[model samples]
Target: MRQANGDVRVGGPVNNRDVAEAHNYHAATKHSYWSVRLGGHFLDWANKPHPHKVYQGLPVVPLPCDVTPPTMAALEAVAAFPSMGTSIRNLAELAQVLFFCGGLTKKKVYPGGEAQYFRAASCTGGLYEIEIYAVCGDLPGLSAGVYHFCPADFALRRLRAGDLRGELARATADEESISDAPVILVLTAIFWRNAWKYQARAYRHFYWDAGTILANLLATAAATQLASRIVAGFIDTRVDRLLGLDSEREGSLCLVPIGAHSPAAEPSEVLPIAPETVPLSKREVDYPLITQIRAASMLLSEEEVRVWRSGFAPSPPPPINRKCFPLNTIKRDALPNRTLGEVIIRRGSTRQFAQLPISFRQLSTILERSSRGIPADFLGGSGTTLLDTYLVVNSVENLPTGAFYYSPSEQALELLKEGTFRRKAGYLCLEQGLGIEASVIIFFLADLDRILERYGNRGYGAAQLEAGIVGGKIYLCAYALGLGATGTTFYDDDVTEFFSPHAAGKAALFAVAIGHSARVPGRVKLLAPGAR
Candidate 1:
């Protein structure tokens, strides 16, 4: 049974043991050249959970079938961070945003009875563990309720039928963005779905995968003219209970409140809900570390939530007395005319990158545009970021091969060291061939010690989430400019060592490789099911 405050009656309180467990897990999951070889973990294909969630009894509300293409330019969408403006208003706009961000975009078939369903954002191990749920107030073509987005069917299954935005507002400690929003999207991760392949480290994938999806969601909202803000600091129990999630298996990761200008809904009673869901697989394996980390990071009380949401100032960039190579970016007018929707539909992770160089303009455009910062409550304000980006350049016209740190504030790359290190790049990225083959590798590093001190363990999630969002934008921009990009796993400490003493104390959060793809034309179709 669920309580009025939205806590499921679990056995006992999670305590210091849980926090210790999470810490141990993080230490254990770090990949070293030797650790990877010794682990001997293999994918258990036979027990793979169904990628889609199915609710048996809920009424299905199909989103508009004919979604119009957004007219916002791809680059503009990546850079747009609107606040307190237009609302989503109707079902069509909502559908457009949802489809572009998380809908099933394509189906791929491999030789030996293997088929993969790909979405707009790239996922590690191609395991789609993230799930999207919408909690909203009444609007055109829909009613107030909590609904689960069924991507396979392009519909939402109503889980609880009522205006539940108030519960969310409370969960977030009345964060202005959420209280004023007409619609809130909660992204959750199913542990076993990803852990089957990633093992204990699947906990990290939870935020990485969700971050990529948020990247698309934020851009799509911007393209459709809806103001969006991410709410990462919330009462975890209240949210999980509000969504009827079993905290042990599935839990809320982050919340996105879409639209603006609506008055805060009056507080209302949230009734108990125990919706029946189809089993993801015949059986499920439990990962205690996942539950422990989530519980440890959770803000237990509304007061705690409010205090946590106050936010912290990121450490200022190191003194810039040296010569900074300013990026030569293309003007907005000269950017490709492709719309964000069109680019997302055609976007895919590059499986194989050609050993050719991309123009400096292309690389500069991505850096200059995507680093504008995200609009979120945890960031304290727009134009602030929790992570810093560094790069290893193997090939780019007019730029020497070397290691550099991207100073977004100066719109320049601070050259740290100069020389070819493609082999080292390949080694740092967990020995992936994509590292050496791609034209350049971007590494997102953060000062975890400072972040954790300021925001506690939850800051770890915030940093990883922000990195994934920025990396995802790079994917869209790369595809928009006829280049290819793919996210990669890395040897964490080794990455810091490679870019030392500049990146010395920072921890590597995420990495992406960008260049031209070696695949044949038309081998993988990127168009939506019925589009020109």
Candidate 2:
């Protein structure tokens, strides 16, 4: 294994109880909540990390702007989750998928005169660290090879000049899905990108942010009728080397096989390329803690991948001893059929929302879609839930606004209390006003104690990934309804308390705000040449 500063040995199989305790202690004492506040004040946003990956004098191609695919037809939202079979297997379709999933969506001029461009998913610190690469067989227009997605120009730059899905399939130890996939999406995170703001915890945000993006990718693929699955357990270094990424600086997170094929692919001639890449920022500042936690959880071999992937087990429900609230259930057809594409196009982090009451039906639709079973490898085959969802209902028609617990099994919202928590909601989300402005805020709480104890250090990976998948789905669902949604960070303990007895000991995993957006006049175009 490539050694780096602060790297820990996360190289073994651990049970659930041990993993859970490690996570709990890490969150409570070792890393602790209070440490974050102090750390935040010390951060230098002015001296924030730079964006460009400085290739210096390396010969690089400026991908064409025409690489972006046009947005597709919006399909109505369906309650039942369908496993997509085929897709728009063309260059244009591929470009569209890439753009919608990772392209720059909008640009805003900060009051300080800084123009910040946002992407398809809501990132923790808006640090676009996660990079996407494509490995495929010959398609409609593009060639068969490995290509890096250049979001700046919305194009792909060829790296390896031959079909390499076979190599990936082999690296993944002949995982059936990859063996039959026409295209595979590889997601890798550049550490310093997000760690600039969140420091060590930013490692987790890598999964969180990427998960949200994957959510968009999966939903869009489904709309196009493409088959895709999240493959978290893989030979990390092998895939990293295939993409020619510096494993210490940027590491592969997950692999997604898009579109199905009848026959398996043959392995490519694996050549080792140690081409020197660019530095992400002008002068690099290192954060040891981030690397330590990441290294502790890295999976080294194909056998290890299989072990980690199979070792996962769903978190057991909280003991039935506590008094649970009654829930509000709705019919499946009551949901709208807004095509997933339409939702993604119109979707944005609700920068501003009218605190107007949304109909209870809207709330019901979001809950239904967000919690619908997700297809993932870590999920243990049975739509298993790795995180618990709790909500701070700010306002909704006929629903008393307060905190509540979502029972996916019951398909209902169990009322935990009845009152307004707009201010508390905002406060809990580190004072981001979006929380208070949103109609409903959903918080993902995981029993880290139980999870880590069962899965070991790697449990952290499953928990974050699960939250991201669900959170990402909720984003699409909100947009499908013509509403808006954005992922937000929160004060872990405060969230549990705000939800009270129902969520007392549970730690906050992730959060999202759902509501009507303050519509911008004229469809705001993003990434238009010279438009900024």
Candidate 3:
């Protein structure tokens, strides 16, 4: 038995040349009417994995307590990106970025004193399985080292003692942004932490969970005046080894470099060290499919990474002169005055939604801010997003009750059909009222065939992560406008069919519902940042 990324498991790596494994894994994990009803999986509360990663007996580096978060308006922040060559930041600013990206925001106490400590970004099932690490050169108030961010206690523990940005450069094949960056943020996922609930499907959630955190990080970075870019192509084994990660238990998802214009370090020896870690649960169950898929998607060498990175090539362009509604964003003065930090603290998954209507301008504003473009490697220039947003409009002022297509580059909404879809919307979203009662539901659809062709098996993760990021941005935009929003799983094929013809050959990646909150009292107490 072999596993993905060369792990010891019950299967061999999926062959990328034929794309058989990519298609099979996606098809196997899809939710259908019968699949949801007959799938016998159940949560084992006794063995629920702990969310935090705790390393035993390590020196703690406490971040600055008085660091102030960026005060830019949330909407503005979403559209903001710093010019890459000019920005330089210190420790205090870095502290602020880490906090806003994954910091402890509030405590929600349910009945019987059951409590859930929510972080800055929204996560699926509130399982904070995504872990953030920073590798940096010496900066003001901080030293050069590889460090892991511990959100539970609001501090960092040095994982390796020395500057390793040069090592990151080598792993990424000297990606421009990464090579010159003062700091690189590496995001990884702990399998059992989420697999305890989602099983084999938890692999996809790795990127989804990280995507939400990234949405926050990008917005906060923009507001913090720090330039950042997402580097998706990297040698998996090298990066995992550099952080001393046990690749069987955890693997790097993506590398994000911050700031620039510094000299790139030459690659040095990468020694191995394994520090003991607190066990996540009393017992852990291995999901062989995850291991297999991970191994299949990995780039084994620098030459392979170079080829993978180069394949981002050009994505297809959108239709020209198509009849589309030109987006009408709310004037800056009328938009939310709330800052990025305030919006993040106030944001949460809306439980119930009212049938109240939201204005078209609000929807327009969301598209405008979120569509400015993600500074990412997978996306090439204009109209290169792997995902396309489709909407189920149930209750929106001046918009018909039907499905629609959104063109980010054109900044327009093209109506797919004009008819009531509330009942159909509910049925599609795994039968949830969150879909039926919302002002609009945004569904991200991607050409998996094209993505896989361009990015290899690993492109599967990239597509899913991109959806999660956009879904996250929609959440922030809705919250900034005092609306409720939630991410949901849907009957994958049904979504494609519902918006068919226009959505032909495209697969659904993720979905989000936005509208007025029902505000069911006492379910979970809300905590605003200033008061919390």
Candidate 4:
């Protein structure tokens, strides 16, 4: 019964021969009319998961808040590589990266006295399930230890007191890129936090949410002149053991090594321990589907990780020889003058988009800025990505109203079937007004067959995560230009069908709507803060 989209049976360990768990999970989670009509899922507000995870009885190490905010232009900062020839000199600089990446940037108190803390990265359901931890050799102003970043109070809680980069390097198949780094940041997700709202589908958010933070993490690192890269191919259980996490309830997602100077690290020695924790809720409901798919995606051994990373060569799809609209983006000198830290602080998902047209330059700038390429382990080699961008242009300065495919190589939009598709665009995005009202909606589609064949079910997670990263970049780019943006869910099969032949075998992974915010009239003006 593995027909996908509807009839598919996925059970037991997923092998290379049977890589249908991702297909099944993707199919099972599709948001179609029939599925939504029949599947009744409701939020249990009384049992909501706590917003923060606190380690009981650990000494608090407050991070410095006076770290200088990065002054580089947000567009150039987000678009450039983190290969700068500089290093993280002290904890304040690292704190700058951490704060911009995951720390709370602003707090809003509602009239009801309920205080809401907005984090740097955009999270699903505002449920911040992702957690950040650091493992490092000794560095200025900080010691060699394993510490969890407590964003609630802007502090670190030490979990182990020793250098563990060697252990981390080994868990990542001796990835040499991170060997000389003074610090490595590990991202993990606690199951119950997001599952409280999304159920089994929360597994997908593990990466989607992290991808947003990573978008900021990479940009901030580059702005701070630190070299960094995302390592996704690591021994899952080993990393979990390193973090001393309860494997089923919480697990590692990826590791990022920052800076390039450090001494050799000692091997990790983690004892069997479950540190005490504050309860997240009065009770937690278990989602077996999450565990099932997470297991299906796990790499059992270090050698397996190496092999998986080695085989991550997904043959590029057929090239787009037919370039349609030539892209005209802003010149480097004319790019936005806003600092990344300032844009991050002011950024919020646009809840209301004005029914207006954004200049062609703005549209092209966002595309060019976000598609420069992402730096992650799964995406080996230069400019490698699994998802292709498709667009439904509703209103723009000079562009025609139609659906088109974005060719990063050609720097052009391949004209798919052209015509006004506002109604169709809204329907594809689950009948949301935001999709219809926005000047344009961007859809990310991935070739699951090719990706799964190369990296097994785990590639599914990477694809979603990558989409999130690109969407996150689009979000930041929009805000930097004094516009607004928001992420939206789509009707999977319908999106693929709308772009036929060109998008035939692709799976719809993510979508984002971008345009001017309604709160401000015509076009909002942004202040350019002077950078250091």
Q: What TM-score do all the candidates reach, one by one?
A: 0.94, 0.86, 0.94, 0.93
The lDDT, on a scale of 0 to 1, for candidate 4 is 0.82
User: Can you tell me which runs of candidate 3 are displaced by over 4 Å?
Assistant: 1-18, 83-88, 311-323, 523-532
TM-score of 4: 0.93
| Candidate 1 clash pair list | none
Residue-level lDDT for 296 in candidate 2: 59
Q: Worst lDDT window (10 residues) for model 1?
A: 1-10
User: On a 0 to 100 scale, what is the lDDT of residue 197 in model 4?
Assistant: 85
Q: Cα miss at 208, model 2 (Å)?
A: 1.3
Q: Show where candidate 1 strays beyond 4 Å.
A: 1-23, 111-114, 321-323, 520-522, 526-532
Write one digit per residue (lDDT tens) for candidate 4, span 340-413.
98999788777788879998899999999898877788886556788889999999988889988988877888
Model 2 misplaced stretches (Cα beyond 4 Å): 1-37, 40-47, 52-84, 109-114, 262-264, 311-338, 518-524, 527-532
Per-residue C-alpha lDDT of model 1 across residues 249-318, encoded as one tens digit per residue: 8889899988977655776776667788888876676656566667778888788787777877877888
Candidate 3 lDDT by residue in tens digits, 29-107: 7889998898777888998889899998877888876658679999988777543534457877777888888887878
The lDDT values for all models are 0.83, 0.70, 0.83, 0.82
User: What is the C-alpha local distance difference test score of candidate 1?
Assistant: 0.83
Q: Tell me the deviation in Å of residue 18 in model 1.
A: 10
Per-candidate total of colliding backbone pairs: 0, 21, 2, 0
TM-score head-to-head 2 vs 3, winner: 3
Ranking by TM-score: 3, 1, 4, 2
